[model samples]
Target: MGLRRKLLVSIGLILAILLVLLYLATSVILMSSFSNLEEQLVLQDVNRALRVLETEVLELNRLLRDWAAWDETYAFIETGHPSYVAQNLDDAVFANLRLNLMIFVRYPDQILYSKAFDPQGNRPAEIPRGLYAYLTPESALFNLPHPDSSVAGILPLPEGPLLVAAQPVLTSRYQGPVHGALIFGRFLSAAELARLSQMIHLNIDVRAYDDPSLPSDFQEVRSSLTREKPLVVQTPGANSVAGYALIADLLGRPALITRVVATRDIYYAGQAAQNYIFLSLLAIGLVFGEATLILMDRLVISRLSNLSTSVTRIRTSGDLTERMAESGKDE
Candidate 1:
């Protein structure tokens, strides 16, 4: 082959090797690093969502404390009178607070008064039957020793998961004879979840952890999560990534699953960067290869071609007088 063709082939082979290395470095190292960073950020978002839920529970507990320490509530638990319910425990209170339940119970499983409301319907509703299971004599909701005792956390029920709190009934001054326990509950309904999502600016989904009919995605994540590995992050689609976590109930069992879905902005940005780098390298290689061809032609190939043509002419004519010219270059 001619020198120019040979030079092009050599340069092409070398550049191809370099490009392969570049592809591997970008795909394996650069993108991997960006993927890891995206996962970490998603995990952080999930944690922030969890903290928001915890704040909701804490707020519910504060509301419970306000009622539990009221003198009217302290007397109503003993007297079982309708006057307190008439004056304070109206439908408007539940609607305003968005509360689903209020229960007054004496120690050892004696329920004095209870009411459950449906905020969406703007009416009173029956309390979930499963709630009584937690109110058993051996239950922790009412099993308190001191007047300052209070408890709150998630409560998973067939209707839905609830944010529940309980406190011992006390005088308005926070003084206590510890008569009984006052309980309050609010379901984490769709409206509530949407409000929470707005508050945190993230898409949140919740599933019952122990339910057999959970969606495949939730089941997949649930099976992967353990006490040791409490969180799972995954990419379900090209445009979005999801983070999963387990929420334990007041009984310390995994009762609910929470998933946060976010856009793949970080990963997408990395992909764009990779494309830019590859294209930039390709352009540089082309420029370098062209420059190399020009230098070869100027410094070596053109002079060699001229010498060969002179030698051929002298051989054909049988003339020894002709000379082969050389350039000033070392070649």
Candidate 2:
């Protein structure tokens, strides 16, 4: 090709190569940054869920301890009159607790009586016959996967694994060696789970098991923990993900495996990142485009023009050795 055409092609090639390199480099940097952002978002949600759970668990424990200390409990254990114990467990406490907290009395054979906080007051019920086989004659408190002689065990009901926080009831009024155990029961209800979800901005679920081979109840409490509040279902939605952590309550209930959900329909944050990448590319293109022009003008065009003038002068003087006077420059 001609000299001019060759020069034009060389410059175009150089520009094309520079642009492609920039796109590759920027894409790597942007992708890494996006991954880091996702990790940070997930970490934030997990921390939030943990905080709320800690607070709720603490409060529940406090309430249970308070109930155990009530005078009516002393009266019931002393007199064997459950009626007085039921009377003391009122709506005020249940409403304050936001749910019906039950206390069951376990006998040698089965749960002798289970008392719940009803709307009117305390309601008593007998333990299920199916679960009677799990009771014990022991005087000490025991956890689930109950011994054969174990008395009534506190269980999270409507079916989630039980949180059987049992304490042997002992008072000056009781005759036997620690008259049956006092069992505290609290279910992992939707509201309690929702509170956990809100704290983390993510959906929450829990499963408990002693043997990994056993099946479990996977109850979904909320939608997602992402800032966007995405949907959580059998299958995750677009822009959705899930994470989990295993925890065991203080009562030594079965290991509680907690699932934290993160999801959203729209890639609001990802789209924003992409837009930023595009803008950055545009700015870089402009800068390089301008730089290419300026360099061509100064190094190629201007310098060549000066070289031509020097050649013309030398030709006119007929002196082949006449060196060009260096312009206001060192070279």
TM-score of each: 0.95, 0.62
Candidate 1 per-residue lDDT, tens place, 86-195, comes to 99989999999889999989765698889999999999899899888898767878786578788999999998999999889998998877878988999999999999
List where candidate 2 sits over 4 angstroms from the true fold: 2-4, 90-96, 99-101, 106-110, 116-158, 161-164, 170-178, 199-201, 207-237, 248-256, 263-271, 290-331
TM-score of 1: 0.95
134-153: candidate 2 lDDT, tens digit per residue:
34443334332222223222
lDDT of each: 0.90, 0.53
Candidate number with greatest TM-score: 1
